[model samples]
Target: MTAKQELKKSIIASVWFMFLTFPIMVIKVNTVTHTIDWRWHNMALVGIGSFFLSMLWRYLLKKKEEGGKKDKKAGLSFIQRLLQEKQFALPGILIITLITILFPHIFSMYQTNIMTSALIFVVLGLGLNIVIGLAGLLVLGYAAFFAVGAYSYALLNLHYGVGFWIALPIGGILAALFGILLGYPVLRLRGDYLAIVTLGFGEIIRLVLENWNEFSFGPSGIKNIPKPGFFGIEMSMQTTTIYVFYIVVLLVVFTIFVINRLKNSRIGRAWVALKDDEIASQAMGIDKAKTKLRAFALGATWAGMAGVVFAAKTTFINPASFTLWESVIILCTVVLGGMGSIAGVIAGALLLILLPEYMRDFGEFRMITFGAVLILMMIFRPGGMIEDVRKTYKFEK
Candidate 1:
């Protein structure tokens, strides 16, 4: 192309870039009485800056073309390639993990509490990932299983005097049974139909707890549930209980690692195939009923574990705590993180849980902001932050 033509094209491109970048730079304002606050000013600045930065980068490319310089390429060494495999998130994980390990006592009590909450949510995300992400089932009532676990621990310990450790597995089994029972009837449903059924199931569970005053103690909830003890040492003391934090962290890590393994296993492959095309998978010899039940059971099993940790951590139980909203949030975590991606689910859980905790001061606006964020994420990135590709089918006739 001629120089004049190329220069004109560059000018036009730069102008269009600026036009596109303008809206991103606009700041929103909220006013109350004499006070004025900028809504999402930080986001606006970042968006605007990023746009211009991209434009400048493109302009540089055009200038390079005019100068007739060849683009350079370099082959990476073995170690360099390995290092490059380290994702942007690796450093943050390492830092957090190191801090949790190296200076357990140095941090304040609230910091520990937040870490505990985050870990519990991680477990919840892992469980839901199995159902929704892997199996492609839309579960709107995961917290029902969570409630089952918590209530099991509460009733078992309060009535039969079962210990925390003993009650944990029992609670999980109960939740799994309920999961299978629920899955049996709804295995044939999908999309909005499946979602509505799960939602009803969750509500029914909650309503039962609320109305079964004789059994559940109504809304009063069970209190003083025992936290998990360590090395036969009671967790009543703060100093020794910090060790439980590491235990929960390890559990979360192990859960994710196991989930990753299973997702790549025969069962995982079958679930993905089912997710993509139920009829095709069945034609290839996959057992439709068994696969669906497995997905429900695995997903509920994860929620059951989280429920155990949650009860152990809070030392309390109530129907209010395990509501439909909780299930929705868990669903959001799975959906926002990209279904079937372990890393994405973790990222989603962390953001969904931690962001609210950080925004607690926002009061009523917190929920509004949360909803807005969810809508924005769904609109802009429907596939979520991480995408999953199902491996080959593992079914055989």
Candidate 2:
């Protein structure tokens, strides 16, 4: 579309959004006086801001497209050229690594904790990436696996005095088993049917955790879960945050390494084939059942490990902690980052987690702003902030 047409469309959409959200934006509840106040100025600001921002975004997109065409005609852009050079790449990586290693020490404890949380989400996003991004599965109940992992560690520690390190692997194995169980019944399902089944499964897990008071401790949840140790040396409150930060960082790196390997392997190719066309994949000798099961298993394994870390870090977990909303947030991280891209998942997790904390001063309106940003992202860059260049599907000959 022409730039003019694009700008016009954006303006229209922004105006429509402004119209729909005006009441919510303008109206305020005064809990002190028990009265409603309408702030017309805030509504106007939102409307004007949306319109101008949309126009600016469209203009930038047009410029980028134009630049891309020119670059294709000529050669790689300067930035791309620099990236291709090993001399620049090695130093860049080293610098980034150094910064990452020192980040917890550099930042305040509160910020470090946030970074730790973001890293956990990064792990979760990477796991989901295997299922939805690589395997082309629509799993709406992914948090069920996360909860299973957390609870597994919690119960093991409570009953048998299992340490965090031992319980971590056990939790992951249990979650993988559950993933296979979920995969078995839903193997024949596809598209929306698969989504619905998975969503129901997530709810079923949560409900079980809630109602099974004797087994799970129900709504009250388990408390005082053991913290991870360094050579059995217990960490105090001040040091624990940094320790968890490093642990999560290590896990994130491991996750990225494993995912990168999987993405380039023979099984990965089969997954892409299955994702593109099941009939064609079967004709090409791909075992759909095994491939699907493996995807679910691996994905759940990462989430399960993350769950163990979460349980250890927080020292408490209840059914409320593993709600459908948690699944939605993790899914959002994947979708917002770029489904099949590891770098994108990391960036998306950081953005979603840190952005809210940065806007804490805005109080309730920060959520509104956050929602607006997501909507804009969907419209402008649905592929995510950093799209994966790799193909998610492979066509059969």
Candidate 3:
């Protein structure tokens, strides 16, 4: 499109947005003083911002389309070349490892804790990737499984006096079982129906915990949850934070290694087949029900493990901690990073989690900014930040 046409389109978009956001952006009601405030400046700012953003959005979109056209003619992408080529690969791996080791020591405890939390989501994103990215299943209530893990650790420690180390695996197993439980009923359902069921399932778990005071403390939540101990020794707060950071770092590495292996396994191929076409995969001798069940089970297991760590890190557990929004954020991490791509998912988790946390000064506006960024991402780059790049191999005589 010509520049003049693009400018016209942007102006139209800006006008439409101005009209749509008038009530919220251009007007404010003050009940205490019983006064109506007309914020014309807000409208002006919105118009100017949207106009420029629209233009930039169009330019990026055009660039993306052009890039897509050129991809067929191009050689291996930077990521692909770096991973497959020896010279670049070792240095890249070493750099990342060095950064990971130095992170906890270089940053403050609060930052280290934040990094730990982001890593938890990285694990969560990978788990969800199996079900959503590979199996093409829509799981809107993933946080329910997350809650299952956290509550498992909390109750186990609260009643039976189980330690974090023991409760960790137990939480994962319970979550996998819950995944199977939920998977059974939704095996036949697909698309929107499956999403609705999963969403409802999440809400049900939260409600049960909220109402069952005898079992779950009924929203009062379990408190003073002990952090993981090293050989039954109590560590100082800073030491504990550092320990948790390392533990999470190790877990992230393990998760990446396992997921990378799975991406090329026979079962992974089956999942891809199922995702591409369920009926066709079944015709090709793949068991749809079994594949779906496995996806749910494995995905939930990761969420469960992350949940155990979350409980240990926070030293508390409550239904409020695992809401639908948590599920949304986890899903967004996978999508924003690049589904079926481990590196992308990690980057997504870090960016989405850390970015929002660090922007506390923006308060509620931060969420608005977050929403805007996601919208822009979907529009300009629907495939995600780092789209999953499939590998190609050749057999020569």
Q: Which ten residues in a row have the lowest lDDT in candidate 1?
A: 71-80
lDDT of 3 by residue, 1-397 (tens): 8889999999999999999999999889999999999999999999999999999878888987888777552633566455567788788889999998998889898899899999999999999999888888999999999999999999999899999899989999999999999999999988889999999999999999999999999898999999988998889999999999888888888888888888889888899899889889999999989999999999999999899989999998889998999999999998998888777788889999999999999999999999999998887767777778775668999
Q: For residues 312-356, write the lDDT of model 1, one tens digit per residue.
A: 888888899999889988898989977887877888888999899
TM-score of 1: 0.75
Model 3 scores a TM of 0.91
True-structure Cα RMSD, model 2? 4.8
Q: After superposing candidate 1 on the true structure, give the runs of residues whose Cα lies further than 4 Å from its correct spot.
A: 1-96, 235-237, 389-397
Model 1, residue 165: displacement in angstroms? 1.6
Candidate number that wins on lDDT, 2 or 3: 3
- Of the two candidates 1 and 3, the one with more favorable lDDT, higher being better, is 3
Compared with the true structure, the alpha-carbon lDDT of candidate 1 equals 0.80
lDDT sort, best first:
3, 2, 1
TM-scores for all candidates? 0.75, 0.84, 0.91
True-vs-predicted CA distance for residue 5, candidate 1, Å: 24
- TM-score attained by model 2: 0.84
